[model samples]
Target: MGLAVVSLKKGEGRLLKSGGMWIFDNEIATIMGSFVNGDIVLIHDFDGYPLGKGFINTNSRITVRLLSRNEQTVIDEVFFEKRVRDAWEYRKKVVDTRSCRVIFGEADFFPGLVIDKFSDVLVVQSLALGIDRYKEMIIELLKKVLKEDGIQIRGVYERSDAKVRRQEGMELVKGFIGPEFPTLVEIEENQVKYQVDVKDGQKTGFFLDQKYNRLAIQKLCKNAKVLDCFTHTGSFALNAGIAGASSVLGVDASALAVDQAAANARLNGLEDRVQFLCRNVFELLPELEEKEEKFDVVILDPPAFTKSRSSIKNAVKGYREINLRALKLVREGGFLATCSCSHFMDYELFTQTIGQAARSAHKRLRQVEYRTQAPDHPILWAADESYYLKFYIFQVCSDR
Candidate 1:
């Protein structure tokens, strides 16, 4: 079939005009050519001016995901090769090239694909249905690019098991894209070691986006008692222990994650200084408060409370509750490193929530520094979802 044409309503192309790549269903006025859903479509304004080319799907609310603004561009294997090369080049310049996010979906201009390189292994997630069709091509091209750099990806694991795929009318998939390898892979970052379970771990096995943020606590935790809440795999706690913290308590509700954290602690020879606890952080925080327990440093790196904008109200409350409890549990002049991973809870809203928490806890916060996800997880200005992580380190002062 020839390329389908999608025309936007008058004045409805404002977002696409302002640099955003999404063309919502409500924004479209008409489709000029007949084509199957998930087909490549040419997007145009009502006046018939070509805007760009995107993959269109009637199943998802995000109807069209613009692949390129250049009207003359071709969507083929060569295009994907260049995209992968560009992503790699950017990573080499701005991030730790060893084991970082290679393509951050829309942030890397790939729209619906994410790739992470862990040593000689790569994990891929193709979220949107439109991109799933090109998944094989992308994987093959990426392998070629890596081989040119003298890196051989022994295996490619697909973690496209996200529930969001249902909205795209696609089946959830998880397995080795190529040859099978041990699902567990070990890698190091910020002088800390981790055993990433690619087949079963959260969000592509390991959360590489927090690579440097975990290292940011080295100075604040030296010889001090540290508490890491929602410590998935105990990354922050391990960093604190390795940084010479007197003692570290890493808490997580998941027994499996706690076990993994313990294993990582042993792997790093930090078991003596770091301990893992299986408990709900919200429940444990109040219990610790009741015991008048205080820590020199507290790190809150909770999973996203809400994924949709509709739940932002409840998500904000959750953030505030945790922040308030952490602030109250910190020793005077101590540090509190808290963050929200929800894109719905944007920067302004997150900071405002923390302020409210401080007031309620009768504590004052001295802003130490504000950091987002590591550079490997680049935030595209036009694509707001790419800028989800909001990390802030603040000194807690007693109002008393």
Candidate 2:
């Protein structure tokens, strides 16, 4: 049977034509042929002009995720091999390949599919039904490509258990993709070692997007008293300790994360200088301020306060509150590192919110540097979702 054809309404596919990957359900004008929900389909302009090809899923608000702009490009093992190889090569050139985001979903041209490499293990998250069908082939091709580079993948694990799967009419499932190996994988980043629990840890076990950001804080931390808020697994704190910080306090609400972080500190032999505490950072910050406890450097790496645009108001408030308290904890002429991982909190809005926090705290902020997610997690232009992280370092000073 011939493939189904999807035609876009006039002026409806502006995002798609401008290089974005998604075509929303409401933008489609008609389906000219019959096909399964997850099958590949041809896309066309309303005036009978061929546009491209993509996989279709009526269950999703994103109706079509374009696979290629070229109408004749075939979706097969050869095509997948090229995509996998290209993603790997790009990572090799731009970031550390020892452990990194090998394929970053939409940014790497594989919509709704994320593959993170932890040492020799691969954790896969397939979020959309359309790409879920081709996931196995993509993994095989990726493994073959890595093998050619003298890298042998020990195991492949699936973490397609995010809540977003329900929106695609798919059940959340996670387990070993092939043969099982020890889920406890150890990786080294910026000379800091970590025991990443691929089986039970958060978001494929670690946030590799902050890989370089953690490295960027080393110079600012040497011999400085540092406080790392929301320190999951003590990544930033551990980096500080490794950088010769006088003392580091890493705080998180999760006791499990605290324990793992302590273990990581021991792994690096920095347990004496770096301590893990299980406490609410929001409450702890105010207490520290009341006690006049100051830090030479304060790092705020909170989770996304809002994931959607509708709750941005509350998100802004949350961000502002934390930044205000954190600014108060920084000693005069000390440094502050703050970041937001919510794409909904765009660069401008996040920056503005921080400025409000500084004004409210009666502090002057000297901008040091601004950064985003590491090079491996490349931000695809026009595809706004891929550009989620916004990081900034500033020197905090007394208003005088």
The C-alpha stretches of model 2 lying farther than 4 A from their native spots are none
Q: Write the per-residue lDDT of candidate 2 for residues 170-203, one digit (tens) a residue.
A: 9999999999899999999999999999989998
Clash numbers, per candidate = 0, 0
List the global CA lDDT of all models: 0.92, 0.95
| Lowest summed lDDT window (length 10), candidate 2 | 10-19
Top-lDDT structure, candidate number: 2
Tens digit of per-residue lDDT, candidate 1, span 1-400: 6798999999897878988879999998999889888789999999999999999998988999999998789999889889999999999999887899999998899988999999889999998878888989998888898899898889999999999889888899999887789989999888899998899888898898888888888989999999999998888999999899999999999999999999999999999999999999999999999999999999999999999999999999899999998988999999999999998999999999999999999998899999999988998887888899999999999777
**Model 2: lDDT of residue 346:** 97
Query: Could you list the CA RMSD of all candidates, in the order they appear?
Result: 0.9, 0.7
